[model samples]
Target: MTDEAALNALREAARLSPENLPLRRHLADQLLASGNLSQAETEYQAALGLSPGDHGIAIGLAEALVRQGKNEAALTALDPLLAMPEHPVRAGVLAAQAMLPVNRMAAAHWYRYSVARDPSQADPELAHRLGIGQPSAPPPSSTSPSPIPSGPAGLPAQPPSPAPAAPTQQPSPAPAQQPSLIPTAHSPSVVPAPHAQPQAAGGPYGSADVEPTAEVEHSPVTFADVAGMDTVKEALRMKLLLPTQQPELFAAYGKRAGGGVLLYGPPGAGKTHLARAAAGELGAAFVNVGLADILDMWTGSSERNLRATFAMARRNRPCVLFFDEVDALAARRSDMRQAHSRQIVNQFLAELDGVDEHANEGVLVLAATNAPWYIDAAFRRPGRFDQMVFVPPPDTVARAAMLSLMCRDKPQAKMDFDKVARATEGFVGADLKGLVDRAVEAKLHESIRAGRPIPLATGDLMTAAKTMRPTAVREWLGTARNYVLHANESGAWDELLPWLRDLR
Candidate 1:
């Protein structure tokens, strides 16, 4: 039989036997193959009603809705699946859910969970696509686990008594320490001893202690992939690249100079992307240490983590240490707050000021935060962030560039670039990309329903623009602008004040 005949047979069987969930599922598969996503979604939902525990049906239905440009609907469909108890791929479902909302923290948790559950899934590609990182190596296998040291005599470990099984599993035993294969400039003998002070009790500042074993994997991003932000790119090249390329000139300034750069702006303005691009351009190792990465559940781990992060950055010279959300980590602390938060903030302040002035260690620190005002005053002083740049919302020229890049491969009908740019006055880079994605999805869905080629018309784009409002609010922009104005008038930041005026 032809492919169409087989699909027709499946549909007829499903219609004749509505009670058979397998038949319904098969019908849904056939519909999907024929690009009839609406019908496929209906059939998948029917199958789900019959077999509520079927994760396959749930995923299929959610994906169908996603293809139909209904991401919210897809998220709703997955909510019940996420609440299920003890599924092997539950982590995968949770990750998908986080992606729908673009919640990076939640997504990172789910990605980690997914990898922990199935060690074989610890590939870097998925994490890179999600704008996170995966560990370079797969976690040790449970069947043939690595042996942990018991004592000085290397005693064999004892097995624990069995208990009632639970759905959520505890982490595996810590892997044994391996010998270092690479040589380092600093000798291990000269390294400072781990402090023996008693850690403070956990309080409102959360755990101040960060575990030495805790490490986050970040997928490296290259400069070629970043879409726009030419001005920001050029500024980073001048500030970071020029010094390294010409070290003799850099040395002339001596030890008292060379500080970090701060990129402050509204969220989704590509600050993180710019940091990654600079790292890639300069051939430097990219280390992303965010506030969430450092916050530990123990009393002194956060501070220790901060120290470890800086040490690692220094050791791995020609590196870029990116703090994506600095305000959360270095917030101005009130005297009444618990001691832990204040300690972490102070540790950050010290690290920011401790970069070697004359060594030209080739360590470039790039910190980004939407709420710059919330950061502690010490971190913003001249010696810490020598240069601060404001990354504003894209203007018409940049918006057009972003749209063109987003629609590069899509089959588009005649589009009015001017109208689209004008319509997206306050939209950030990410917002414009989302608009393009929505329009492409709508066009694909329509084409599938009509059994035609995927071709996006101007109307489809216009409809997408109407549905996606500017994510940034006018009130928020006004507040930020006012803060910039106040700072400029105060003359507190001589270098950044001029840029602030121009931005406004």
Candidate 2:
């Protein structure tokens, strides 16, 4: 039969037997081949519903979405498959293709990740566009296995028919022709292939590399979402928020909106939340970077990653690049034995100082660290992380507010939050969440025994609070007290004094 006739036959078969997963997939594949993208997408969705977690069905669906320019939707479809322990090759390649237009660096990583695991999955042309594969090299000869088709505008084309099997099924042994995503004994690494492509100019990785770490997000979580820390809010508004809002006003006083603000406090004091809120309050793009995003076992990769991250922020002007556990990436070089570790810190400093081709004109860098004492001192200079804000445990009023907020969505009685807050003195935001969880869990048990639903009363929460310890807050306060006493020469820890006094 002709191709079109074959497709029609499959379509009729699928319509007659909707529950036949393989038939549905085959029809979707034929529909995809015939350029009926919408029909292909629908058929693929039907196949996925019949057999969810079927990798082939998911990839076909994602490919159809991408072909229709719904890159985000394609990614959403592929995310579960990507999250598997052994990343599916087609899923990874399709994800990389979807991400390329918006985020080339991330695309490169995903492409490398897939091709490393299964070399036959490599799409040399797509890799070349992403600046990770060899562009100058010739295409595969007629004698070799046909190259995976790069669909219209490089949307991931369908791969050679893959058995609709579990992702754990290993591929035939193929040459290890691509870069390795395998990490070293020390930390995760992205070891480049012998013919690894070069990063574009305009600084390391360039403006083209829009997303180096996590995707840049437009945060809607304003300071209002934050439970308390009114003082921290105010400080952030003045130091970070106001300048962005009234740039011309700040400029009159020889001040600029973009600079670094370091937030240090006990764990679960909402430091990360506050940074996100600051970005939201300004209505800017927020990029949250962590240690895993920056560190690589290979030499110079960490610095390159850091530089790429800054390049990404610079591209997204009025961006808030918030780094959590900043101390890990910016640890005291004096204490570091490894040269690579020190190089990472130096790269961090250069990026903060805008010492490279890319300037941080409108990018406000905010970082949070529980152990502020461990960060390199050079980061404290006037232009770097100059504004060190100390976030303290929430006061009684704040605790009450947090309790009410936590209970807002839970099934609970009209309980007095203030009494509970007063009783739980040293509990931080995390502790309060734990308290609510405990109360809900206990209520669940009670409901099970009574054979009915039970709403949590104030007494239930009080009992839960009593069972938990505020050791984290106590330990953080103790550490702050020591730093204030002996290391207050520069008075960086002076703002922490009141909290220390309260702790005593």
Candidate 3:
């Protein structure tokens, strides 16, 4: 093919398959070369979405941000590169940092260090502007210095006369009190200072002197406080509580190592509540690992945080590491673009594998993701999060239970919960709770308007329902059904499949 035709074909490939990182990167480079900054920025962002830590994509995005007068944002993007010990784009990153007004001190230090490391990088004009330049050594003094004499004590007692020091110079009133030749404790020395030596009984980094803050122990939320979800409660008892309480029986039955469980469904479906209840039932220490908590601006910090989280869980045996919004951190590896994300996923996988069934004892991993489809396939294997539980929206029975729990303390004039349940076909636990709250609020509003005591009635709830829409719709349910079906067929979560199907 001709060069022009090949270029056209490459562009077509990129446009047709934007999800492909390599193709996107190539097209982005081509667009940039052609001065199509807008298109190039989009392509770069697409590439980044696939591989978050791509240096080329990161640099491209940073440059785009700078061109848009978002210099601070550009610098923010380069912060991760700075944290990396040997980032390839160090020069470009330093240049970006130098451009930011708030990072002057750090930028100046980096520029000086970089120039010292490689003089070729030094730019006289830029150095002059930044008030940085090659440092000059001090010149030697012309006057001759006197030598010290050793005493019988073996210590330097007095300065030896420099052959009478040319009598003429000394004639000027022999300095009143000769300065001592001995150095003070604070003086610089070839040897390390006494205080500089490492101390025992201290933290390795010398942080022992600083007292740590008192740790606030987390209290697990119990099922009693969770207003409703009888079906969910029962499921937890049979599937989780029974297994945990009678491990000997489970082991004898050859079901001791079924792996972890994943609770996935629409948001606010009581997934977290069910997970907490399971933790309480198992009497396990609850560890909530949120994506926001693990993500850091520095490269490798995310992976480090992941390791630390697992280590903490291992240390606190019989613990439940509840990863909330798990998809944000554990999305499909095929969709991952950044090295940092890959490292984090790999560390997570390793830790998951390291959890010994016998050693872990009561320890369990409960991850909940609203977007289950986004979860990495590797994580869904038989030995990992093999039990994928679909915590679907409450059925009529669950809705009735929720309604009764919500309006128990309120004044309801013989409300038919069955009718209300039928009305809320697609409602999740949270949606039901919200409906009750809104009804109560509306009743209160009406009472205040009429200058009377709040008298909540069935009519008020019906009115609230008209204003409130169920959060989960047909499309969400369809997506969830597909995921559940896929998991069932793959035998990835056969242990939990029967219960999951019953929920559907």
Candidate 4:
């Protein structure tokens, strides 16, 4: 087949398997080669989203952007990769090319620095434009001085070219003979990528091929920042926070600080926010892994992503690794028709168990799902999501607190939050926010008609809440009741019984 036909076939395949990162990247590479800059950019972005922080893919994306005369965009793409401690050589070259139009000196610095590292990529036009070397001059030999400056501050003074040696007789000086420039004003200092960490040798989840897309951050939100759920907060303090705070005391009783806690509730009920608060309370690194971060269309890649995610959390000790919508990743294997899907579930179980050399001594695993009943039974086993924490919808007091906070910034009259909270019974945090938004929107419309700004009041919120029902609560409670009634063998979900009874 012709090259065009092969490219078309690959394009169709990529379209069919949109989540296939390698295939998307290969197609992007082909598109770049074929000079389809726009299409290539799109595919590269998709692939980058799948396997974030891949240097090769980032460089390819920047190159494609630069070729399309989107120099600003290309520089944006390269900035993060260039900041990484270990980046590909091409990243520097592409960055130099992108920077040339805006800043010649910076471009020259990057070009010379890159070429100094590996001379084969030397470009005459770029070198000449940056005033580094003559366009007509022969490529530098190993013995020649590097065009890069001696230090970070200024350009190097060129010495006269050395006399040519015979084709194969001269001894070459090592590249290290030249002084390595410190990070310049344009190039930032060497820093490890957010997901980059040292891997343990031959460990099950220690492969460097996959870098977790989930960011490890020190959450600043404590229980004080969280609005309510006093019962849930107390439970978390005992189950997670207190143990970490008094590790020695807990250890004496044969209890370790780290374990898994599953937070299941209706969507937008502040499950994620609570997890972050737990991390903040412990002063731990929070790694929030979403469904998109783990699922991959390619075989084995999903498992690798999952392993790498757990590996990352392990490396960052005292980490609260919270997986949101985890039901998709750890669903019942018996119900899955695809072997790959079951493999992902199995991989998740193994990671939780910390199989082989991997240990979860200091890692606190937390997962949130709206449909916890869908997760595998094995996940509920001891040491792996053994604690089922039910996050119920906001109570009246919690709703009042939330309403007061949500309205703090808005122009308002003397608002009775309790009145509004009482009217919107069973509303979750997100539903309350939406009610506030609708009220503000109505106020805006009324203000326009009256030609004056109108302030929000208790009545405005109550009026808005009248039209909106507790949409997610009913559906979620319906499902939870069935599980609690029939599948509560281990009684992990016994706490949900009260909420389920309220549904009656």
- Candidates 1 and 2, the one with greater lDDT: 2
CA lDDT of every candidate: 0.63, 0.75, 0.60, 0.75
Q: Let me know the TM-score candidate 1 reaches against the reference structure.
A: 0.54
Clashing pairs in 3: 50-336, 50-337, 51-337, 51-338, 52-337, 52-338, 53-338
Candidate order by lDDT, decreasing, is: 4, 2, 1, 3
Q: Which residues of candidate 4, in runs, are more than 4 Å off?
A: 1-208, 355-358, 446-454, 502-504
Q: Model 2 over residues 182-270: C-alpha lDDT tens digits? A: 22222222322232223333212233332365579999889888887887788777765787778789989977668888998899988
Per-model TM-score versus the true fold = 0.54, 0.59, 0.59, 0.57
Instruction: Give the per-residue lDDT digits (tens) of candidate 1, residues 326-422.
Output: 8777778663133455667888888876745543356787899887777777777876776777776788887877777677677877767667888
Q: Which runs of model 2 end up more than 4 angstroms from their true locations?
A: 1-211, 355-358, 448-452, 502-504
lDDT of 4 at 157: 25
- Consecutive 10-residue window with the lowest summed lDDT within model 2: 173-182
Estimate, for each residue in 278-361, the C-alpha lDDT of model 4 and write its tens digit: 899989899988766776532355678888899898889888999988887787877754445566788899998887533997
Clashing residue pairs for model 2? none
Estimate the lDDT of model 2: 0.75
Residue 36's lDDT within candidate 1 is 92
